[model samples]
Target: MNKSEILNTIHELLKNIAPEMDPTLLGQEENIREALNIDSYDALQFIVALCEKLKIDIPEQDYGKTATIKSLLTYLEKKII
Candidate 1:
């Protein structure tokens, strides 16, 4: 999938896992956990949800690569195909 499609999917998953997060306040480069006020557990939940929905395997070591929307987009793009 293209980055736009990937991004939209990520947004949808984030909404489900973190309804309290205000997308309006988020920047692509901002740290998702800090910007969304989510803890590590919630962050893990988001990652899990993303994997389930997208059928992508994100290794624990690569979790750090997805700290921001921009980074996550880049990581997913590479992993997806």
Candidate 2:
């Protein structure tokens, strides 16, 4: 999928995880955990949800590389490509 599509999917996943979160308030480069107040458990849930929904396997070692929306986008883009 394209970057826009990937971003949209991520937004949807985030919304499912944090209904109170305002998508517009999410900074592309900001750390999602800090920005959304997501704890480690919630972050793990998000990653699992993303993997299930997108059919992608995000290695545990690479989780830190996707700390922000921009980084996640780049990671997914590379995987998709």
Candidate 3:
């Protein structure tokens, strides 16, 4: 999938997980935590959901390296497809 597709999928997932999150405000360079007001548990939940939905096992530390939407999409693109 392309970057925009990946981002849109993740954005929808985030919206589903946290309705308060505004996906439109999330830019390629925005940190998930700071941009979405998510905590560690929230991130973990998102990771789990992603794994279940996308059928990929992303390491917990992966999120640490994926501080932005673009980086996260890049990581998923590599690990998933």
Candidate 4:
């Protein structure tokens, strides 16, 4: 999918995982931890959720690339395309 579609998917995924999260902020380029208050377990869950949904494999060492929503979407887009 494209960037916007990837972004929207990220937003939707986050909302599913955290119902109270704000959709607008989820789309920001800033750090997702700061933006969403997601801790370590949540981070792992986020990665797993994305991988499961997109049927993509995310290397353990590459977790840093998904630290932010924008970055995660970018990563997913690259993998998908």
Q: TM-score winner among the candidates? A: 2
**Higher-ranked by lDDT: 1 or 4:** 1
Q: Which ten residues in a row have the lowest lDDT in candidate 1?
A: 17-26
How large an RMSD does model 2 have? 1.0
Over 17-49, each residue of candidate 1 has an lDDT whose tens digit, in order, gives 678766546797999888777888988999898
All candidates' lDDT scores?
0.84, 0.88, 0.79, 0.78
Error of 4 at 45 (Å): 0.8
What's the TM for model 2?
0.93
**Model 2 lDDT, full chain set:** 0.88
Against the true structure, what is every candidate's RMSD? 1.3, 1.0, 1.6, 1.6
Clashes of 1: 0
Residue pairs with clashing backbones, model 1: none
lDDT score, candidate 3: 0.79
- State every prediction's TM-score relative to the real structure: 0.90, 0.93, 0.84, 0.84
User: For model 1, what is the error of residue 34's alpha carbon versus the real structure, in angstroms, after optimal superposition?
Assistant: 0.4
Among all candidates shown, the one with the greatest lDDT: 2
Local accuracy of candidate 4 as per-residue lDDT tens digits, 1-81 = 778777777787777767787866654568886677777888788889888877899999999898766677667888998
Clashing pairs in 3: none
Q: Model 3 reaches what TM-score against the true structure?
A: 0.84
Q: What is candidate 3's lDDT per residue for 21-53, written digit by digit as tens?
A: 687687778787787888888888888888887
